[model samples]
Target chain A: MIEEKDRTLKEKSLEKAPTGINGLDDITYGGLPKGRTTLVYGSAGSGKTLMAMEFLVKGAQKYGEPGVFMAFEETAEDLAENFASLGFDLDGMESRDRLLVDHVHIDKSEIEETGEYDLEGLFIRLGLAIDSIGAKRVALDTLEVLFSGFQNEAILRSELRRLFRWLKDRGVTAIVTGERGEASLTRYGLEEYVADCVILLDNRMEEQISTRRLRIIKYRGSKHGTNEYPFLIEEDGISVLPITSLSLEHEVSTERISTGISRLDTMLGGQGYYRGTTVLVSGTAGTGKTSFAAQFCKAACERGERCLYFAFEESPDQITRNMKSIGIKLQPYLDSGLMQIHASRPMAYGLEMHLMGMRKILDTFNPDVIVIDPITNLISAGTEIDVKLMLTRLIDYLKLKNITAICTSLVQRESTEGINAQEISSLMDTWINLRFFESNNERNRGISVVKARGMAHSNQIREYMLTNHGIEIRDVYLGPSGGLLMGSSRDIQEAKETAEIAAQSKNAARRKRELESKLKSLDAQITALNSEFEVQKEELDKLSSEEALRSNALAKDRSEMARIRRADLH
Target chain B: MEDAAQNNNGPELVESDTTPDPEFYILRLYVAGQTKKSLTAFANLKEICEEHLGGRYRIEVVDLLENPQLARGDQILAVPTLVRRLPPPIKKIIGDLSNTERVLVGLDLLPVGEANVQK
Candidate 1:
C-alpha cells in the first residue's frame, strides 16, 4: 500500500451523503456530515417522514450508497409502497441490495425492560441492516414512537444518546424523524440533545391557507442555514427553498434578454434590458399586470433563456391556459423544462417564507428570468417596512445573481397617488406603469415608462391591446382627449365623480402665464434704465468741462474790471 | 378572477372561527407501571382529562420503568411525573394515583372549574 502522501487525490476525499435532491447540496454547504445523526422534527403532516425517506431513496438510486430505513411507525411494505406516488423504485432498489427497509416494531404493550438494558438491540438491528447492503445512510422514521412505546424515560434517553454516538461511531449519515410534542420537540426530547444537527419542520395554516415550513434549528461544528424556509411536497416530491441569506458572490452572465414587446424593449432603452436588472411593472388592478409580465417571460423563454414564472394570484394551469388564449403558449416550454410556472397565494405564507420559496425555485431551476407577477400580493403578507426591506433584499439578491428579476405590483390607481409609489420606487432600476382610461365609449389600456436608469426611454404613453396574436402596441393615441379608455362605463362614471380633481389646473396655468409675462416686462424696464444711466453719465462729463471754461472767463472779466478801476483811480 | 372573489369570502369566516385562546392548559402524562396504582392513575387522569382539561390537554403516556432503558428520558427519577407542558412555566408533579389537589393545582385546573367539580 502507498503512504498517505503518495496516495491518489481521490483517496483524500471526505465521505459524503449526496442528498440526491437537486440544489440541496449547495444550500447544505456540501452534503450532511458522514456518520452523524440529524434529527428531523416536525409537527403532524409536516412532511418530515417523507423528506427523510426521499433522502434515503435518492441516496440509494442516485449515488451508489445503499440506505437502511429504521422505520418505527410504518411497516416495510407500507413504507415501500408510499414511494410509488413519487416514482421511487423501492423494489428495484431492494432487489439490487441498494436499499433496506427495517421496521423496528415498537408497540406500547411490549414493555418488559428489567435492568441495564441499553439500546444494543437497536444498534445490532441497524448494524445488520447496514452490513447486509453495505448501506452508507440510515433513517429512523421516528424516535418518538419508540419513546411513546416505552414508559421508562430514563432508559429511553440513555438509549438515544447511545444511538447517536453509535451512528457516529459506525460512520453512517443518519436521519432521525420525530413527531413534535408539547414544549419539547420529540415526545421524549432526548434525540435533539444528542443529534449532530437538528432540523424542524412545521405545517402552519393561516387564514385557511396551509404552508409547510422547514428550518435548520442547529447544525454543530459548521455553518448552516438558520432561517425557516418554506418547502412544497407535491406529486414530484419535496423542494427546499432558495437561499435567502445575502452573499455578494453569485455567478453572473454578461448577456441580454428581450422584453417581448419591442416598444417595451425601447422603453428599457435598447435591444433589451441587461441580463440582471430587476424590472418593476406597477399598475392598478385590471390593468393586466399578469399579461404584461407573461409576455416578457414568454419572449425570454422563446429566445432560449429559461424563465420561471411565479404567479402568486393564479394557478399554473390557469395561467398557462390564460396566456395561451393571448397567443403566448407556455406548454411547449414547460415540456422542454425551459420554462417553469409556480403559483400560490401570498396569504399562504409569511413574507420571509415567500422569499425562501422564491429562492428555492430559483436555485433549483437556475432560470435566467424570474417573474413574480403581482408582488403587491406578497406585500399583503407584510407591513410596509417589511415589504420594502424584503423587496430591497430580493432585488439586491437578483441583481447580484445576475438573474433578471421582473416583479409586478398592483397600484390602487393609475397614478400611485404619489405616496405609496415612493416607498418602492427607490429600489427599482426601471418602472413601467400600465394605465386604464376611457376615451370615447371604448375602454383602453396604456403603457408608459415611468423610469429607466442609465438610458433615455419613451415618455409618451403607448396604447397597447392584447389581441389573439399577442400584446399589440397601437399608435401614440394623441387625440383631442389624452387619457385612453378603461374599466366599465359605470366605473368611468365613478371616476368622473371622484374626478372633482381641480379643473382649476387650467386657471392655475393661466395665472402662471400672466405672472411670467409681468416678470419679463419688469426685467426689460430694468435693462433700459441701466443703459440710460450710462448715456447720461457721458453727457454730464462733457457738460462739466464746458461749465469749467465758462466759470474761468467770468473770473477773468471780474479781475480785468478790478484792474481797470484801480488804474483810473491812480 | 370571479372565482377568487368567491373563494376569498369562505376563508375570511373560517379564520375568524379557528383562532385558539392563548391561556389553555396543556399536560403530557408519563407513566411506567401497569399495576393497580398505574391503572388507577390512568383512570383518574381520564376523569381529569375529560373534566378540567377537556379539548385543551394533550396526554402522552410514557411507560419507562417497564422499558427501563427508556427511563432516562424526561430525567425521570421516579415513576410518574405529569408534565404540565405548555402555556408554560412548565411544572411537573410526581405521584402514584392519590394526590388530587396537588394535581389540580399543578395542572392549573383550579380557580374556574371548581364549581363544576365532581369532588
Candidate 2:
C-alpha cells in the first residue's frame, strides 16, 4: 500500500482545473489546484463572487465538468438574478443536470445555540448537491458569513476544516470566497486551511475612475504570474487580462506594407512601415492625421486585409464623411467587412478598462492592422504617465501578436508636444511627424519621417497639400530666401518657373526659324545660277548653226555629202 | 433568464412555505445519521415537547443522511438542531438538547425576556 501511494504521488504531481478565462489560464499555468480549496479574498464589491461563479459556470459549459454553487450570503434567486445580465443561464444549466445551486442563509437574530453541535447538516446538504450533478467543481461564495452568523467559533472552525478535508477527499475543485481582513488573507484566516492557492481581487477608484485588478497571492507547487492583472466583469464573463512587464521577445518582420499614399510610401524607404511595427503619426490639429490613417486603412482593405480602427474623438459617420473629402472612401471597406471602427469617448472608461476592451476586440476580430486615431486623447482617461505605460504595453502586445499598429497623437501644446511625442516615439518602430508650416500668410501641411528602424527613409520636409481629389506631395521649391517654400507661394513660384521655361524655349525656336530662312535664300541663288548657264548654252548652239549655213553656200557640192551623212546620223 | 429562474424556483418556495398556525407548535429535529447523538437528540426533544405543550406540538425527525434535501428548507448547518417552524420568528437550537432549561427558554416556554446572545 505504501508503494502504491508513492507511485500515485509520483505519477500525479499536481493536477489543475482550467478556469477557461481568456488570459487567466495562461497566467496560472492552468487554473486552481484540482481537488483542493482555493481561498479568494477581497473586500466588498471586489468581483470575488463573480469570479467564483464564472469559474463554476465556465467549467460546466466548456469543460463538461458539472459544478455546484452554494451561496453563503445571497440566496439562490438573488445569485440567479445577478448572473442573468451577464447572460449565464443558471436555471437552464440546473435543468440540464450540469449545475446545482443552494443558498445557505442563516439569520443571527432568530437562531439560538443551546448546546454543542457539529455542522453535519451543512456537510450533508453540500454533499447531496455535489452528488446530484456529479459535480467536479464547487464554489462557496462569501463564505465568511458563517462566522458572523454562528456563535460557536470552535465548532464552526473545526467543521470548516473538516469541510475542506471532505472536499479534497471527494476530489472536487472548490473555491471559497472570503472577505479581506486587516492583516490576514481572509477575515477568518481561511487561507490557513486552504493551503493550495489564494487569489486576491481589488477594486480601487482613482480619479473617479474605478478599475478592477486581480493578483495571485500564493500557488503551491506551481509557477504563476505574480503581477496584478486587470480583469473585466464584462458581458459573457470575467476576463482576467494577464499582463506583466513582459520580456522583450516579440519576433520582428522585415516585410513592409504601404502607407497608402504613393509618395508617402516612397518617403518611407521606397516601401513603408514594417509588418508588426507601431507607427506614430503626431501632428497639430487639422494636420490630416485622421485622413492619413484612413488612407492606410483603405490600402489595407484594398489588399484584402482586415483593419480595426479605434476613434476616440469623432463618430464613425463623421470619420467616414471627413475621409470622403480626401478622396479616401472608407464606406466600402466598412460595408465589405474589411474594416471595423470602434468609437468611444476616451474618458468613458478607465485606462485599464480601455486596454481590456481593446485586447478583447483584438482577440475576437484578429485584425491584421489597427489604427488608433489620436491616442493622445487618452489623456482624459488617465494621467500622462498612465497613458504612456498603457501605450507601451499596448505596443508590445501588438508586436507580440505580429499586428501592425498606426497611432495618431494630437499635439495640443507646441511647447510640450515635442517631449510628449518623444515619450511615445521611444516605443514606436517608426515615427512620422506632420507639422503645419506657416508660410505665405497661411498654414500649410508638411510631412517628415523623423525615424524609421532599419530603413533609409526620406529626410526632406516635403509639402503636402490636401486637395479635394487627394493629398498631393509637391516637389521641393526654394523661395527667394533659399528656404523651402510651400502653399500659395510655392504655387506662384512653380508658375513663374513654368513661364520662364516657356519663354526660353520660344527664343530657341525663333533662332532656329531665322537660320532656316537664310538657308532657303542660299538654295534659291544656286537654282538661278544653273538656269542662266542653260540659257547661255542654247544661244551658242544657235550661233554655230548660222555660221555653218554661210559656209555651206561656198561649198555646195561638199554640203550635199555632209547633209546625207547628217541624215544617216539622225 | 429571470423568468426561467422564477419558474424553476417556484416549486421549492411553495414546498417550504407551509401553512402557518400560531397556536400549533411545529418542531423539526435534523440529524445526520442514526448515531447515538441523533437518537439522544430525538428522545430529549420528545420529552421536552410532551411536558411543555402536550398534544399541541407536532414533532418531525429528519435524518439528513436519508432526506438531505430537507436540510435546505430550515437552513440547517449543525446537526442535532431543533427548528421552531410555526412560530412567527423561526429559531434554531444546536446540540443534543440535554439542557432542558435552556431548551424551554429557547422555545419561549419559560417566558424569558430574552434568550442568551452567545456572543
Candidate 3:
C-alpha cells in the first residue's frame, strides 16, 4: 500500500484526452486533462459552443470515445443542423449510440423554491445521459444559463463546484463553456472552479478584417504552448494554426533538382535547387514571378512528381490560360492529377487560417513540390510580423516533410523595402531576384541569383525574355564601352560595329586603286627612259660606223701605204 | 360542536373524524442527523406543541440523513425545519425552530387578538 501511494505521488498518472483538432493537440501537448473539467470561455459568436461540439464529435468519431453534449443555449436539433455543414453528422453519431445530445431548458421565473433545493434534478439527467451512451467525454456548453435560472449566487456557485466534482468522480473528460465576463474570464468567474485548464477564444475585427484567436490561459500538471493561435471555421471544422510552437527538427535533403528553366538551372550552379529546401523568387510586378514558378511546377510534373500551386492572385483557370500564353502547358498535368492549383484571395482569410488551410490541403495532396505564387499578397491580410511568423512555420513544416517549396513574392516598384519579402528572403535557402531593365524605350527582363546558401551561383545578371516559347535567358552582351547591354541596345551596338567595318573596307579599296595607277605611270616612265637609252646607244653605233667608213675611205687612198697600217691594225 | 367533542376525545379520534377539524394541527420536523441542533429543535418544537396546542396536535419526525430523497418532496434546504403539513396551506419554519413566536405565527397558531393586530 505504501508503494502504491509512492507511485501515485511520483507518477501522478494524469492522463490527457485528445481533442482531435488540427494543431490543437500539438499546442496542448495532448489535450485537456482527462476526467477533469476544462473551462472554455468566449464572447458571443466567438465559437465557444462550436469548439465544444467539435471536441465531442471528434472524440466520438476519431478516438472512438463516446460523448455527451448537454447544451443550454442551443437545442440539440439546432446544433445538429449547424454542424452538419462542417460534415460532422451529429445525428448519425447519435443513431449509432456513440453520442447523446441533451438540451436543458432553464427559465428563471418558472423555478420556485419553497424551502431548500439542490441541483439533483440536473445531476440525475446528466448522469442518465452519460450512462445511456457510456460516454467518456462530456461537454456542458454555456454554464452561464444555470446562474440565470438559479438567481442565487451562493447556490449556483456551490452547485457548479459540485457539478465539476461529480464529473471528475465519474472519470469522464468534461468541457464547460462560459460566456466572457466584463473583467473576469467567465461571466460568473467560473474559471476558479475549472482548475485543470482554461482556454479563451477571442474574436476581434481590425481594420474591417475579422480574426479569431485562441489562447490557453492555464493548464495544470502538464507543459503546454502558451501562445495566441489563429483558427478558422471551415468545411472540415476548426483548424488552429500553431505558429512558433512547432520545434525545428525537420530533416534536410542534399539532392539537387531542376528549376524547369534550363538556363536558370545553369545560373544556379548548373544543377538547380537542393531537394527539401525553400526557394524565394522575388520580383516587382510584371516580372514573370508566377511564370517562373510555373516553370518549376512544369518540371516537377514532367518528372512524374506531384506539385501543388497556391495562387492568391489569380484563379486556377486564369493561371492555366496565362501560363499557356507563355508556352507552359499545365493542362496536361492538371488533367493527369499530377498538379493541383488552389486559388483563393488573400483577403478570404487571416494569415494563420490560410496557413492552416494550406496545411490541411498539403496533408491531403501530399505533393513533392509546393508553390505559393506571390506570397506578398498575404501582406494585406496580416501585419509583417504575423506574415513572417506564419511563413516561418509553413517553411518549417514543408522542410520537415522533406517537400521542396518555391515561394514567389512581389516587391513594390520604386522600393526594394518590402519588409515581409526581405524577412522571408533571409529564411530561404536560395534567393532569385528578377527585375526589369529599361533601355531604348523598352523594358527588358533580367534575372540574377542573389544568394545560394550551399552552392556556387552565377553573379552576372542574365537578360531573360518571355517570348511565345517561354522564358529564355540570352547570353551576356558586353559592349565596347565595357558595359553589359541587352536586347535592342545590343543590336544597335552590333549594327554600329558593322557600319564601322564597312567604311574602313571602302577606304582601303580606294587607296589600293590610287596606288595601282601610280605604279602604272612609274612603269611607263621607266620604259620610256629605257627606250631613250636604247636610241642613244643606236645613234652612237651609227656615228661610230660613219666615222669608221670615213676612216676606211682614207685607208683605201693610202692602201699602198696601208700595208704598214693594216699590219699595225692586225 | 361535534368536531370540538372529537378533538377533546383525543388526537387519534380527530384523525377518524376527518370533517375539517381545524383545531387539530399536524406538524413534521425534518432533521438530517442526531446532532445537537436536531435535538434542540426537536425539544423546542415538542415544548411549543404541548404548551400551545396541548393534545390538539400530532408530531412526526423525519431523519433526512437516513433517507435524503424525502428532502425533495417538501423542498427542504436547511436542516431541522418544522413543516406544518396538515393545514390546507402548508407553511415552513427553518433553522432549528428556536423562535417560538415566529414559528407560531408561521404555523397560524397565534391568538385571535394578536393575529388580527399582526395582520
Best by lDDT: 2
Return whichever of 1 and 2 wins on lDDT: 2
lDDT of each: 0.70, 0.84, 0.82
How close is candidate 3 at the interface, in terms of C-alpha RMSD after superposing the true interface residues? 7.3
TM-score of each: 0.51, 0.77, 0.67
After superposition, which runs of candidate 1 have C-alpha atoms over 4 Å from their true positions?
A1-28, A61-64, A109-120, A151-155, A192-195, A234-238, A242-265, A270-280, A288-408, A416-430, A436-446, A451-456, A459-570, B1-119
RMSD of 1: 23.6
Instruction: Compose the digit string of candidate 3's lDDT tens values, residues B1-119.
Output: 23433343475445736746677778877786787777888888899899998887888787765545454444454456677766646676655567666567777788546956876
Rank by lDDT, descending? 2, 3, 1
The runs of at least 3 residues in candidate 2 whose Cα sits more than 4 Å from the true structure, single-residue gaps closed, are: A1-11, A244-280, A294-310, A315-343, A352-371, A383-406, A412-431, A439-442, A449-460, A478-483, A513-570, B1-22, B34-40, B87-89, B98-102, B114-119
The share of true interface contacts that also appear in candidate 3 amounts to: 0.00
- Candidate 1 C-alpha lDDT tens digits along A1-570: 566565643433444566866435655666666677788888888888888888888887777778888777888788778878677777788888988877666544323232223444455556666877899898988777777666658877877777777788888888888878787877667555554677788987654455566777776665667666656564447766544434446565546568898877776666666678877888877777888788888898888988999888899998889889999888899999999989888887677678777876877889888898878788777666556766776777688778887888878765844345667788777788887776556667888888877667888787788988788876543333544333354355555656655556767889999999999999999999989988999899889998999999988887788897765634
Root-mean-square deviation of candidate 3: 11.7
Docking class of 1: incorrect
The most accurate candidate by DockQ is 2
Relative to the real complex, the DockQ score for model 3 comes to 0.04
For model 2, give the TM-score of chain B. Answer: 0.73
Poorest 10 consecutive residues by lDDT, candidate 2 chain A: A412-421
